[model samples]
Target chain A: MTREHLLPENDATGKQSVLDRYDLWGQYVYGFLLRALSSPSLAAELTVSVFDAFREAKETGLTDLLARARETAVAALQTANELRLQEATNFDFRMAQRQSSDDGLLLNEKLGKAQSALEPKCKTILEMAYFNGLSQKEIEGALNLPDGSTGTRLRRAVNDLRRVFALN
Target chain B: MDLKAYMTSGMLELYVLGLASEKETREVERLAEEHPELKKEISTIRKALDEYAKLHGVQPPEELREKLEKSLDGPPTQAAVSSRPMVKPAHRPRNKKFQLGWKHLFALAAVLMTIVAIGMAVLAFDYSDRLAVATSTNVELKEDLSKVSAELVEVKKANTNLQEKLGFLASINTRQVRLNATRRAKGATVLIYWNTDQERAFAQWDQLPELPEGMQYRLWAIARRNFEPLSDMQSVSSPAGDIHQIAFVPGASSFVITMEKADGPDYPNLSRMYLQGSLN
Candidate 1:
């Protein structure tokens, strides 16, 4: 879908209609949480909580909604001790094989290309840390990398991703 | 701090991903507050992550909307209500026999009034103290704001300079001419970015030898067969590291830099030539 279709239009009054925004962005927030938490049920629960909080806070922007959803998901993961290394590994596989048509979501072409251009290990490290919320030491142990290498790898991966993005 | 190194260190990505340690987070926040470039970089990282998240967005189950609406429409739970500060009951059940007499009521009113008076006095004093503290904080904040504003001005100036240089380098019409050092100055090279479209040129050098006192470097643009003297002579003690803008003579076949006495005629001294480069 085009961005115009994905984004909610303001009402006649020119102010963003809250329910419209929720409808438009709810799936994206859910997916973000699901990616982070790796559980459909937990992701669903937090997605609802995120929207409720967003409504109560009178936040209309997608950025704020996503930020709140991320925070809520991360807090839930921390509280439930749900950081699963296996799930992160699976996520890496899914990311590699993921296609825009699979989800019927408007994937950002630039970011998708940039992400796909990353080395497998670098991409996995990013997924483990960003999506799985694994600490540097946890990532090193999980990947069997030498001590202090996780940070270096993570930095290089992110830098590479940024460089690729800049190039494209 | 080497901002380029810090920016590429990936700490910003980690920070944006909410994975940075508390100390690292603080450092990033402090630096971002002080440096506009860092702040811009942080913003870019956040945007990239946000886009990445959006790229992987999945359509939630349809039933999820119903669940969200039900929760929104439902009344607050007991736990939710209990989390708020307790409010006194608007009315208490009356007992005729336990009612107070007029004299008791008057005495109670007097005591309540005394308590209220003391409470008001205490509140007034607290308010005054808080007001004073707030005023002091406001003054400090103003000072900090002014300092940040000054720093912002300087950063903007630097940013403009960098942007101009980048623009010149990126322009298709701009030609990069490397001026090779002559026999007098070995192992020295200068880069000149000449923008033909804008008729502007900038020169940069790394290791040009220091000239003697009262001697300066002059630039000449050779257009056709005639030499045009470009304004802005560079002294050795001047900022050699900075990219210096020079007059761009149109259709210049070549350029030359020569060292001459500070008081010498405004012309290139062929014998004192230090570097030369041709457009061809």
Candidate 2:
């Protein structure tokens, strides 16, 4: 791998470089947010928010770049969750809305149940990656798992989730 | 190299999940670029995940799309391009991979050929050295054979001479005479094979010790009338059983042998007499 391949094509013009990054990774970030948030509007909003934040960061590493995007999306999701809680002042109204949202909430509920139903090790690994937002390397280090096996555990967790979802 | 093994390795699934490390992701991309089947497999896996995500996708609010489009109006910043490391898909031609493979094969073949050539040269040199030694040995054997052949001829000649002497001794006119040892020459005895008809005498020096270096034994023919010296004598080089011809002596009553100086005097040295016998 050459240095040119590793580095961004042009780093001098920070403006155009940021736009290029948004163009390239915006869809991928949106896709990941859609999976995590299960809401296209929120995913799109978070995707834009990630790029807006990425424009200011000086880190050149690609992994760090993706991490920044994930952090932005996760933080936005947390803020939305806090806002939802705050707005739940009317208990009867909230209950009625929750019942109505139950149609869309079924898949989310099923997915969450599938994650929880996974083997303890797989559950922990998936939780670390999705909920805690730890990288596979971080998961390996934190769990004292051997190198290269974190990916294996993640793959297994996803497969197990698929099976659990299918069984339901 | 085993594409099936690579496909089933679970690494591609991790890549799709974005759980793969940067290095592993790059490796997957590199291998997928190199192998179209792997690339197709990656695409299939991505499509499956895409379908799954889309099944649960919700339509975004129209205002968010508009806002995202407006956000892209500015010039490309360093962070934008650098944020997602764009991997330029490498075009690795099959011919290039084939060329590299062939180059390694040729290099291995060249080394093996050199080793074989060296082995053959060593064997040839060793064989040549052994041939030289064998040739030298053959030459020596031939020379020895020739020497033995020459010696065989000399032995045949000696045998013929002995046969002739045996024929002469078998004649009826040949007298076999034994000379007795005298007091001064104890243990000295000789045999005389005399052909009286031919007046020829041959003497055998029997039990004769080797004389001193500068002395020799002489033969003398004695008669009552005169002390007649017959022939000069010396240590014989022939076999001990051989009979040698002396001077012709007739009408001699006795024969005597004596030790004398290497150059014998005309008169016999009586004190150095070695053997005496009467011709009775």
Candidate 3:
């Protein structure tokens, strides 16, 4: 594609209708697959399947995805921004400790509300992915942050969260 | 290989968490698919986590998976598996088998050829669809772009019209005639618009103290031999911008303006000719 084509163009309604067009089903299958697979390449390939499933689902399965999204979106409100912030910071300090390798299992235990060991970033990443129903595109659109920043932050957040529980 | 260290890295957990970057995700996927042991390790970790989350039972509310499945055009996989009829391949009759020879080889070749042909056809069809979509998208965008381009030209045309009118107004040199205060009237100003090129006149009046209960101003454009009243005045309404422009001044010698009652007469009262100016 030419550079000019990549440059932003406005749709008559004063919006980028093209990118928004992908959200037609708003399954945000791309984001779902990204979170589900955790492997970007796998996620992308599955992205096609999600759409393919979506395309085929148009006749049959689509109602389910939409219903699921709605259900999840409503339940999403329970997770707060304050919780998300705390989860990220707690996760990081643990990772920095160079602690034992059992952090993953330990992190799991701490994930319950009873444990204050949760890192703010980990909570943010989870909340961002699950509750907000934001696609990477939406996150990029809303935050103007690089796509990689989210992944990096997520990984770092997870590591820190694990460390707080001190799994290793 | 250090499989233990690799598995211990804890990256697989994030992989399950779906937190990896595209590049990182791609690398993890490539590594998992390429290495069976790594794939097994990752799946093991995921299984453990999935089971764990399941115990907590987000249940994610009723209709969550159903909603997800609907969007995917796929089923709740668990439902798909459980709902499907079990395969009974073992119970099927032992079908007759042809001994492998020239016939089987030809059949194999034809099957391979057919598959290749079908794949090519699918690729061609997909490409055609992509092209059609891209072309339509381009056409839609181009129409909008052209509209944006047209705005600049429209603005330029409007600007030129305004500039030309301003220049036209600036070119004319004009003088106004004033009459001294008389029995009924005081100070007044009239703006006369003259088109030098067309040799025409337009006139309006302002800021004379309000007229008496039934009086008005009458205008006459006078030539050397004859006189014609142009605009007869009504009482002023608003303080400004309410002045009325009188249309069409026939070829003029000079002008005679007078004061009269609000209802003006066909001919000026010569005595009421408050002001007069000549062609010379």
Worst 10 residues of 2 chain B by lDDT: B51-60
lDDT of 3 at B197: 62
lDDT of 1 by residue, B1-280 (tens): 8998888777887787777889999999999999998998777766666666776677777888878777666543446766688888797667645656899989999999999999999998997799789889989998999999999999999999889888888999988898766544566667788888898988777565565555667777777667688744555422637777888888887777766656657655443456677776
Q: Candidate 2: which docking quality band?
A: incorrect
Listed per prediction, chain B TM-scores read 0.46, 0.48, 0.34
Ranking by lDDT: 1, 2, 3
Residue-wise lDDT of candidate 2 within A87-160, one digit each (tens)?
Answer: 22112321221243443345345444554667787767765555335455555443435667876776666566
Winning model by DockQ: 1
Tens-place lDDT digits, model 2, residues B34-74: 99988876765544433333233233344654575567565
Compute the DockQ of candidate 3: 0.02
Which prediction has more favorable TM-score, 1 or 3? 1
TM-score of chain A of 3: 0.29
Native-to-model Cα distance after best TM-score fit, residue B147 in candidate 1, in Å: 88
lDDT of each residue in A72-132, candidate 1, tens digit only = 7656654552233233323432343243245532354544676777888888888766665
Residue B6 of candidate 1: its Cα lDDT? 83
Winner on DockQ between 1 and 2 is 1
